[model samples]
Target: MRVDDFDFELPPERIALRPASPRDAARMLVADTRGLRDRVVRELPEILRAGDCLVFNDTRVIPARLEGRRGDAAISATLHKREGPRRWRAFIRNARRLRDGDTIAFGGEVQAVAADRAADGSFALDFAGDEPVEILLERAGSMPLPPYIASRRPTDARDARDYQTMFAREAGAVAAPTAALHFTPELMAELDAAGIAHETLTLHVGAGTFLPVKAEDTDDHVMHAEWGRIDAATADRLNAVRRDGGRVIAVGTTSLRLIESAAGADDVIRPFEGDTDIFITPGYRFRGVDGLMTNFHLPRSTLFMLVSALMGLERMQAVYAHAIAGDYRFYSYGDASLLLPA
Candidate 1:
């Protein structure tokens, strides 16, 4: 499909600078088979069935944004993926200033030797230090906020907590699964009391998630690979839920994509772990996820295309139109959407 099919005009004011105080206080727009409905994040449990299960991404957001220098030039690097115990693939700001075998000094904390630049412009940096890379990062790294937000304002201490979801535990992702950001402990308890089951899988969201679909057509877009995992116990339970007439509700596109990747042609989910470059588009069939809870996405973004695939493109267009008019927030720190397709 032409990428233009997913384009829509969004007012600048629709972008949210901060999330709602309680997280669950954020507004939610539900797009289902019946029609669109205005709601709040706190009311999620009331919208679904008792037997339905919510699949969550447990991958934690790492403090991946780093400010450093190579000799006299200032350099900025956002670690996208861990290559090894001491090496990482990073997207550098002043990449032109770097060369293979140059040392980029992070600070007094540590230094990394740049080598092996990827075709995407990201470079592999192997750290030289006795301390673990995580420790060095703790001293030198800042939250890797999305460009839409970071360009507006600098990342502050608040982002250290705000950008991380309550479900964040396993540390690997450079970007948080923004859709899961709306969830709160209270909301989870409510879902439990309401007989709504929830399970977790890990999908280390990469900074590549921020890359634009520069391709004119969906067919030409190259989706970046992201690491993900699903354990056998969780997989068996999820398959059982579906077999017992329940629905699988993916809390974010990350979990949705990973689950779909792990599902067989028979629609039975299995244990899986590794990289997934599953770029969801309108024509792709969704076998694992029955519903999705996600954030408002950018115009002509891969995320928007995924939602359009779930609930027809025309319907999502209308849903987004309503959301914008209703003053609902947008982007990584925006309002939420609960999408249910028939």
Candidate 2:
């Protein structure tokens, strides 16, 4: 499909500069076969079925944005994916000034050598110390906020707490799984009382998620690989839920993509741990996820394409229109959307 099919004009004011004070206080736009309905995040327990399971990405967002220098030129890097214990693939600004094997010195005594520049302009950064890369990131890096938000305003100390979700445990993701941002301990207790089950999986959301689909056609676009894991125990439970006629609603596109990657042609989910570059566009058959809860996405983004696949192109277009007209927030720190297809 033409990438232009996903285009929509969003007012600049729709972008959320900050998250709602109490995460659960954020607005939610629910779209289903029945119709579109206005709602709030805290009301999720009542909106979903008792037997439905909400799958969440537990991958914690790392302070992946780094500012460093090599000689006279200033360089900024966002570490996207870990290639090894001491190496990562990073998108570089002022990359033209960098060449293979040039050491860039970051704050807190952190340093890395640039090499293996990919055609996409991302470079392999091999760190120069025995200390864990996470330690280096902590000393010199800040939270890798979405470019949309970062461009509008500078990242501050608040984002360190706000960008992380209640479920964050396994750290690796460069980006937060924003849909789960609305969930809180109180909301979890309510969900438990309402008999709405929840589960966790790991999908280290990379900076690539923020990359725009520059390709004119969806067919020409390629998705960056993201590491994820679904152990046997969790897989068995999820399979049982489906076997017993319960819905598995993915809380974010990260969870949904990983679930689909682990599912077989029979629609049975299995244990999986590896990289998935699954590009979900319209016409892709969903195997594991019954519904999705996600933030409003950028126009012409891969995430929008994934949602269009879950629902329908025309349907999602209307859903987004309703959201915009209703003054709903947009992007990473934005209002939520619950999409349940017929």
Candidate 3:
């Protein structure tokens, strides 16, 4: 389909610069077989069935954004994928100032040598140190805030905590699973008490998630691969949920994509490890997840396409129009939507 079909006009003020004061205070737009309902994150337990299972992405966001200099010219790089203990695949600004052998000195101890420029214009940067790269990033890197938010303001200490979910543990992601940001300990406790089970998996979200679909048609768009993992135990449990007639609710697109990647044609989920570049579009059949809880997405983005696939394109367009006119927030730090397509 033409990419233009997914396009819409969004008012600039609709973008959320800060998250809700209490995470669970964020609005949630619930669209199910019945119809669209405006709700809040705290009311999740009321909307979901007791047998539903919410799968969350526990990948922690790293301070991947870096500012450095090579012979007086400044360079900015956001590390997307970890190629080695010291090597990272990064998207660079002022990339024209760098060559394969060039070394950039990030003040106060972090330095990396640029090597291998990919056709997409990203670079492989190998840090110069014996210490773990995470520690080096601690000294020199800032939170990799989404450009939509960062362009409006600057990242600060508050964002360090705000951008991470309570379930955060394993670290690797350059981007936060925004939908999960609406979840809180209190909300989880309520869900647990309500007998709604939840699980965690990992998907190191990359810089590619922020990239726009420049392709004229959906067939021409290529998704960037992101590393993810699902253990045997999680797979078996998810399968059991389906067998017992429970809904498998994916907490975010990251979890949804990884689960779909590991699912069989018969709808059985299996263990998965490694990269997935699954580009979900309309007409694609979903095998693994029964429902999705995700943030409002950008116009013409792959994420919007994913939701459109779950719910019909016309339905999602109506959903968005309602969200906009109702004053619901948009983007990574925005409000969320619970989509259950029958």
Candidate 4:
């Protein structure tokens, strides 16, 4: 299909600069077999069935955005993927001034040597230190906010806390699974009392999530690989849930993609590890997840295409129209939607 098929106009003011206070106070647009319903995130326990399971991405957002200099020229890089213990692939801002073997010095004695520039303009940055690269990032890096939000305002201390979910533990992701940002301890307690089970997996969200679909056709767009993991125990439990007639609802696209990646033709999920560049579009069959809870996405984005695949393209178009008319927030720091297809 033509990429233009997914396009829509969004007002600039609709973008959320800050997350809702108390997290669970954010608005939620629920789209199901019945119809669209406007609700708040705190009411999730009431909205979802008791037998449903919410799979969350527990991958923590690393401080991946770095500002440094090489010979008086300022350069910015956002580390997207880990190539090795000390090597990372990063998208650089000042590529015109950089070349292979140039050492860029970041503050606090952190520096990296750039090499092997890819056709996509990313570089393999090998850090110059014996200390762990995580430590180097701690001294020199800031949270990698989505370009839409960062373009409007600067990243700050507040994002350090706000961007991460309560389930964040294993660190690697450059971007937070924003849908889970609405979840709080109180909300979890309510969900527990309501008998709605929750599980976690890891998918280190990369900066590629922020990239736009420049392709004229969906077939031409290539998704960037992101590392993810699902162990045997989790897979067994998820299969058991479905085996017992429970629904497996993924809390974010990250979780959904991994689940679908691990599922067989028979719809049984299995253990998985390593990189996944799964590009979900309309007409795709969803085998693993019954429903999805995700943030409002950008126009013509792969995420929108993924949602269109879950629900019908016509239905999601209507869903977005409803969301926009209702003044729902958009993007990473924005409001969320629950999509359950009939």
- RMSD in Å for all candidates: 0.9, 0.6, 0.6, 0.7
Q: What is the C-alpha lDDT of each candidate?
A: 0.92, 0.95, 0.95, 0.95
Clashes of 1: 0
What is the C-alpha lDDT profile of model 4 across 1-342, one tens digit per residue? 999999999999999999999899999999997899999999999999888899999999999999999998999999999999999999999899999999999988999999999999999999997999999999999999999999989999999999999999999999999999999999999999999999999999999999889999999998999999999999999998888888999999999999999999999999999999999998899999999999999999999999999998999999999999999999888999999998
The sequence of per-residue lDDT tens digits that candidate 1 reaches over residues 1-342 is: 999999999998899989998999999998887788899999988999999999999998888888998999998999998889999999999899999999988865579999999888889989897898888888889899999999999999999999999999999999999989998999999999999999999999999988988999999999888889999999999999999999999998899999999998888899999999998898788888899999999999999999999998989999999999999999999999999988
For residues 33-57, what per-residue lDDT tens digits would candidate 3 score against the true structure?
A: 8899999999999999988999999
Quick one: RMSD of model 4? 0.7
| C-alpha-based local distance difference test score of model 3 | 0.95
**Candidate 2 lDDT (Cα, 0 to 1):** 0.95
* lDDT per residue as tens, model 2, 173-235: 999999999999999999999989999999999999999999999999999999999999999
Model 3 earns a TM-score of 0.99
The Cα RMSD in angstroms, rounded to one decimal, for candidate 1 relative to the true structure is 0.9
What is the Å distance of residue 304 in model 1 from its true position?
A: 0.8
- TM-scores, each model vs. reference: 0.98, 0.99, 0.99, 0.99
